[model samples]
Target: MDKRVTYCTDLEKSVIMSNFERRGWIQVGPEDEWNFYWSFTQNCRNIFSIDNGYRMNDNQIINHFPNHYEISRKDLLVKNIKRYRKELEKEGNPLAEKMEVVLPSGQVATRYVHLDIIPVTYVLPADYNMFVEEYRKSPQSTWIMKPCGKSQGTGIFLINKLSKLKKWSREAKIPFHPQLSSKESYVISRYIDNPLLIGGKKFDLRLYLLVTSFRPLKAYLFKHGFCRFCTVKYDTSVTELDNMYVHLTNVSVQRHGVEYNSLHGGKMSVQNFRLYLEGTRGRSVTEKLFADMHWLIVHSLKAVAPVMANDRHCFECYGYDIIIDNTLKPWLVEVNASPSLQSTTHNDRILKYKLIDNIISVVVPPDGIPDARWNKIPSVEALGDFEVLIDEELMEKEENGCRPTKNSRYR
Candidate 1:
């Protein structure tokens, strides 16, 4: 049997197994902890998809792209965008609103640190101080810091201070924030204290949105994605939300909760949440959340439109994380390019499988559909024509640092 790779942790692997009989795909199992063995063949071609470990779709997105690769990751969400553009408006940028926060008072706090440099594709420091500053100025400064390269909320830390970061780094005897010369820390963003209400608890909405086209950009929300419940009251008192033990936006983490195994007792899926939102909460609030989510994607895409492909097969999909405030106001949290395909529960598997299935169905078309898959399609124009003169190494340095390229010298 021909085989292609799908990688996930053990917990998620078991969940993926549930879909094998229904999705028409065989689960080649009995593998290592994270190895997902599967017989996958496309066009009679015996191609293999190997995910050595967690790196999101960075490898997949690049390996499939012929030669011209782009750099529009966390690097583009730098502090300088504030100076270039007023307010946290998403005119079409991918990381808008989520990375940029407009407080209830209208103060714009960006998750970026340096307003001067953006790493396009090279390695650089990921800044958290900008987020620190934004937090300090906000009515609710408590925030979450994330490593740019982590997914499944693996490296997310709910922190409360600059001193705590330094002290913790010192305890580890490793460089984190203050020791910036060698720190591999995350881009700190002001954490939202007011998570949207769900059954009187804090929860985040995970909308599965895809950017089918970057140029003349096209976007749409998945019919179903799901919500993440923190299993605790919505409190930003540091002592409360500080516990990643309880306040994670990841289903992988929450599903592992002591109560997850109970009968719909732990978390709620998108189906239930939508129904609840429409009935109990009213459709107006539900529509408001989607409206805000659409607004964020539409504008964020516009900001980065200058540096992507417009071909039918070339696409960049995003798993957007959003939190709605008490007043039913939606605030974007972060955008995951390669969201965790690793489902933690039966419901999780069902939603993500359908989402991934739709993605593959669109990208990997069967016979008559014509390979309209984004990566399989050719670029609308030559890469050289639209390519910018950005420095690869320097760009990587800044982007890896999680700072946007603000210094025009590199551009």
Candidate 2:
């Protein structure tokens, strides 16, 4: 087997350890070795974890996290998205509304984009040009444009005037947007009249999810995750970027919300809000919340099974953000392969640590296997970037591959 050690990093690493401990992982060591190492076991076999985010199998450590989303493979996530988009539409779901377009012309990369549109919905939107003319003819009615694949609620817009659309198509024709609209693909929809409310503010539900077994396809939902509210109060005031109160769910933006309050508003654990919503909005809303959560994960997984079932050594976790309209119906907002691992609070550390702990336990062999003790660092300078865990200075090198270098220096 290729024995190079692997390291994985996310802000959740620290918290994941606590989870490990909670699950009964034992920590053994300060062993004389080149790098820090830790071991834990389950089902009679030992599983390993590295203290840093380095992976033994990859060439270079990624300088950034959250930039890449790990799905079955590089192009798999987008392909899976296409499958799910078809599914929701086939079921005749109300959110199945769509748009049509003629492109500028180029190869279409289906794996990266999937939008919902229709040839025949009860309230049909004719082809792109007709939809535009109808809007012009009506003078008062408007439509929303949502682009697939972009995240954090970006690229969705409300177009009221024909001039704005002329500008959009013009922008799409630019050389820089080459792969986007060569013409054949587009998904347009009527915006929701009522996005759900919290603190009198509009927001979406961020439910955390886990895939325990993908071969047979098993998933587990944490009882809670978080609720991200748009920072502005609802208004016809024109949804500009700043009116985040109705548009953004990112904690980074919402914290600056007009209705923003760090202590009691922008962020609230799902468990806490379960009570708040019930006391105010009534118990039924919360009931639908759970129902919607289950449907989303189940349908999303089913949509992507064709690809996931055929892979091994690939990851299977996902973070799905779902929005519930005023009617309390759920709509899939986006799916994340590498969801945020940055622990935002003490609870974050606790939850994250436990998650990693579970991950390691699953990897350890069920029977006792050999322990490959590794190398040692020559000086404190080697441990760079950490304050509490490292000492400073260098000394010796060893040849055994499992022994620590023979000395130290900090004075």
Candidate 3:
């Protein structure tokens, strides 16, 4: 009997298709009987929708959760994190510690220092009055506005004055109303004007996280993530605010700039970035920075685990975009459900190919079969370039003073 696993993918990308083919997995159409489906977010939604009535067998698995938007959507993500911090604070958790934050206008304000990983953000229209109140607190501060449903830096702009949002208020129509409207919504965040610049250019970290489950939360962080750099030099001047090349580090947007370097795709390996930080900022600070990043990543996942669908048959590889300020403080920008698999350069293609390969090895069982009911743990060898970010089961054992088995030391 042929025991080969059959797989199907809606994405025609070489990185994804090549990985499946390399695994000797048989290709099948979406409508065909397949044990694995590397589907788009839209297809995943359709499959899990009650109206569709599509059901997965015990031996089948897919690439996304049914309700990933609880953490992926910009506005929803902020809302969930805010709620998470409040709950922690109510419980008197140390993670919810508050501290003084010095504003741009030299005013000191108390904020949830530990839990304030992301920028001070508010969902637009509904929070318009609150945003106005905060805006008045720091009139000189710059804020960035982004459409909740859009990505790839499509509808992003920086504003220092309330007058700049007049057009948006007019479009939203329900300005300052407490009731949420059905119109296109947005999230405005205080911009990180003093970003940590390397070679006089601004950049952001693009880290990949693989989540196998959310309930007994299991997650892995890929070690080969990279930094995306803006094509133009870093500038905070109002004149340069309109130039995306100077502000945004997204490859899709940067590729259009004249100075865009096709050879390197304007990206630097995370390893190289760490080395640079270690050299300039010292090793201890660099280590602490990374440790804090991991802490934030785990907490961010924890923030949404309660609301996540936590489907057993689904695993998602999330792209975490982070920006570090000049003070060496890393801020969570947003999370992407479907991170771009499109390769920009030769090295990029190689990195993504290996990423897909490792993802398959971790998600699939040892017998080269996709089994949703199997224990979600993968051996260290199977993990490849991925490291365990969190395993709640192991955590629970540790909390109860139970020693983890030798094989379970992957964390």
RMSD of each: 11.8, 16.4, 2.3
Give the lDDT of residue 297 in candidate 1. 45
Between candidates 2 and 3, which one is better according to lDDT? 3
Instruction: Return the TM-score for each candidate structure.
Output: 0.60, 0.57, 0.96
Q: Rate the local accuracy (lDDT) of all candidates.
A: 0.49, 0.46, 0.90
lDDT ranking, high to low:
3, 1, 2
Q: Please, what are the lDDT tens digits per residue for candidate 1 over residues 233-293?
A: 4555656645664577566676665645434435566677778878977898787765555
Clashing pairs in 3: none
lDDT of 1: 0.49
Model 3 over residues 343-410: C-alpha lDDT tens digits?
A: 99999999999999999999998888999888888999999999998988767777678776532432
Kindly report which residue stretches of model 2 are placed more than 4 angstroms away from their true locations once superposed. Answer: 1-6, 10-13, 16-149, 153-156, 172-189, 239-242, 256-259, 281-285, 358-411
